[model samples]
Target: MFFLPLVPINSTTTLGRQSQYPNSWDVVRHFGIRLSDCFVVTQFSADPRPTTASDALPAPRLIALDWGTTSCRAYLLGPDGLVIETRSNGKGILQLSADPATKDAEFAAELTRLCGDWIHEAPHLPLLACGMIGSNQGWAEAGYAPLPSRIMAKGPALTPVETRQGILHIAPGLVKDAGADDHGLPDVIRGEETQLRGILSGKESPASSIIVLPGTHTKWVLLDEDEVLDFTTSMTGELYSLLIHHSILGRHSIPPRHPDEAAFLRGVDVGIGTESQEEGRPGLLTALFSARSLAMTNDLTADAVQDYVSGLLIGSEVAGFTRRWVGRTSTQEPPRPSITICANPSLASRYKRAFLRLGIRVNTAADDTTAKGLWHTAVLSGLLAKEKA
Candidate 1:
């Protein structure tokens, strides 16, 4: 059993920016509710840590890892762009043995068992890992390089662990402080960065663009070419979960057969156009009670509660983005650079339609693209020193 007490990474927080403390603690507490002793992992990198290796051809030249909070996924990319073999284990930074005296040995053994069988054929596989597994409180805090700057995918400061079979390099995560124009947004991500970098690299003419990554904490990133211009975080998903499951709104919800309900659309319409739709503007709490009132008055049905909730969520998202995106758009500004939603199938489909109605293009980036992106970041970082040599 592992315990992660959602410690506030930034306690002396600034004003005007969203609070990361309450939100993070809320998630940690919610996660612990199901099982107090269960081990958990997290994955939320907006870029991959690139490393540049100085070594010549060794064995495996390509290695990649996407380590999240709840789970970790990895791939060993062959020189031919195909996965030669894959390895994974229940062990992640958050779940690794807490007893530091033996944690490394335990982690190495578990990791080796997951990859050792193939290491003999590819003894020197360079590895790269993204996500929460590399945070300061994580396995080892992978340092951040800052915005308007990007880490080159090459071998970085690689740490070798002697597993039962041999050695392995554990990839690190990035951390950064807020700078000018960033409005002091103290946030960090792990695995998603590699995916974003990969997505941008594959483009025919990659330049400055806004990247929308939908997840528990949706990240809106500003990229100036390869450099990450800046970014901001939103807790819409967590807020949605809280309102529907724990708040009074939960009473009216009947578990929609479809997550995106028409009721949701109506809610969005009311919330977004509230200034023009109603005589007096209402707060979110007031709006929430209205849903239940509507249901009781036969103004809405049980099935309609789902959409009503959806409307709250979508409306909130639209409002947030509207504020963030208003003065940032232009007919020549790359057409909003298709929203990249990293979420499950149901919500993904729903968000696609929601965004489409707003005249936005949407598409799902295949899972393979994420893996390839991490692999690309590793090669850029110096992680493959032994393999590349």
Candidate 2:
């Protein structure tokens, strides 16, 4: 029931770049259909005002939400799933009251506060949400869809939570059982599945590709066309934060005025070693000490130390994944799969740099993919039917 509204407005704000309209226009052209119908609104507001009928925008067809642990983003989509406007706030699930008696009420209040005006104006619009909002800790438990599942295949019904406004459909997360290929441990993904669907929507997905989502816990998802073959998670970001703030490697570190790309690449080079070096040199465990050692020797600046350590961790993760999953040997190179990074611009840039250093070319998904994924899921789940207009 919690509806949101979007309207086109003029703004020079682009998602990540300084250019105006070029990137947004490119997305419209890429979709091929509904060029005239599409409205690209990249500007988001922390506190969005209500829209009146006088504005005369296209009617919103759906209200999509990407609600996570630490933040929640809501989007209003017009015909063809064009992003109308977006509202976000820091009231993530973690901010909700801990008392079970008040938790549901808290969630309802938060949703209403986020998009109450839209709900009042468009009471019947379908509402769809993804991410931790459907987890055990979220508003309701939308269980995991089993592994080796089709990304767009229908039929694992969405969990519905009745809110003050209406029923909100929640997408289930994906789960993989412990198996020979999964490092003998099970894995789960909640929010990233929606992002993956968004990345592949309206495109002829490659036969096989590696989708990397960089975050606190980075995910390396392997997809074969529409199906999710397998995935692995790496805690590279979390570890980096821990080391830089709490560990010895970061003891002398200070924030760099600018990024030290050279230092970062040097760390990457060490992590992705030559065959001879790989055979004789120690692994990440031993190399981690070099951050402090190099600093002590005055060979590395305190400001650059953090970037160097970041590169080392990310490079190690890439090297490990490639070796184990790709089955590359010390002497023979394996055929590389197409890699795409779906993340915010900053995080994506870092991962892209790391992969390029390892001789891997990668594609970056659009920044608005989460919203697109939510819309796609809503359509596929029958929450929003395709419109002819």
Candidate 3:
């Protein structure tokens, strides 16, 4: 169910002029060792492998955990605020018992198994977690902090639990402006606030910017100074998965060893309405039908259909955003605020290319903003102090 890249996971990629390792390998082989040695990256840190622990290395005092729907990443941050080490497992909040009777003990047992070293070595270190792990189903009901909010604000409703290891603070998720979303209630975000905090750290802040985190549910957020203004969500990756696996296009959506740029770009243009016509090109859904029909007519190859549909979805996300938010198409060429995408390099590149096709420029932030955000917000929340010892 993961949104994996179209290329062979082991194959190298040549984007424009620069060549790069396979995306999976790039994340796995950092610090020149197996991912097991350093844990998973989730595209949050450039290299998960910690620098050699010299005699002067400060002792770790904080544990930053990015506990998502399917995985839990534990980061041990030294007093210098750098990652001392990381570990990950598949025991996300979804795997926990929702029943009050056993959930607490179950979570404690899971935490101990996953972070036994840290519990034993740094029992005093405070633990902070962001993502679904803070949701109602998680160990604690760390509720959402309402919007018009500071990204660094303390979880106004933290669910703190005292354990033998230390007190663990569950970072609260965010609730958008009431009725701002089509849902009539409000749109919500869990872990991205942390990543945004991390990406903006140390950089000269922009007065306003568009911050995008692309994945299963891509988040397009507006940053007005240091406060989060508003955001929209698009299920591009999730929809892609559904269509490719369950639709008629699924038969031809087999991934390739290497992608066909022509096919992908063609799909993007179609989705963005660049090559759309008045009669048959009704909308994205109708346009998508072309993938199957064109393939049946021998106009498109089966191998390229997947890339084409993918391009359509990604490009559609960009085009839809511009039209809905900016009120213009790439043809009219309205000035767009600089776009900053915080995501894996490969995923970011896809969005970058889609934007470039629309004559918009994109800036990329580090992939590991979740790690950064958690630490920054923790410091702001007074759970973690800023002083570097």
- Going through the candidates in the order shown, the clash numbers are 55, 1, 4
Find the 10 residues in a row with the least total lDDT in model 2: 10-19
Candidate 3 TM-score, C-alpha based: 0.80
lDDT of 1 at 171: 51
Q: Which stretches of candidate 2 lie over 4 Å from their true place?
A: 1-56, 274-277, 329-334
Which wins on TM-score, candidate 1 or candidate 3? 3
Candidate-wise lDDT, in order: 0.55, 0.77, 0.71
- Model 1 C-alpha lDDT per residue in residues 1-389, reported as the tens digit of each score: 33222222221211112222334424534554322232222223466233222111112355566666656665656452345335455466667656878766766665565555445444555555677656654555566555445644343354444445554454543445775655765666566676676665545424546666767777776666656656677776777778778876676668866554577777875555442334677756566677778888998888777677667666656555644653432223435443565556766665655555455565665445566666556555545333231
Candidate 3, residue 282: the lDDT equals: 57
TM-score (all chains, Cα) for each model:
0.68, 0.83, 0.80
Model 3 lDDT tens row, 1-389? 11112221111111111213245434433334322243222233444344332312235667888988878888776554566556766488778766679988878887888786666655667888888878777777788877677664443455787766678888787788656345675688888877778877767657777888999999998776667878878899999889889989977667778978888888888888833335655588778888999899999888899889989888888888876655555545644565788889888888888888888877998786666677776777777655521
- Give candidate 2's whole-model lDDT: 0.77
lDDT ranking from best to worst?
Answer: 2, 3, 1
Q: What is the C-alpha RMSD of each candidate to the true structure, in Å?
A: 15.6, 8.4, 9.9
lDDT measured at residue 371 in model 1 versus the true structure, 0 to 100:
63
Better of 1 and 3 by lDDT: 3
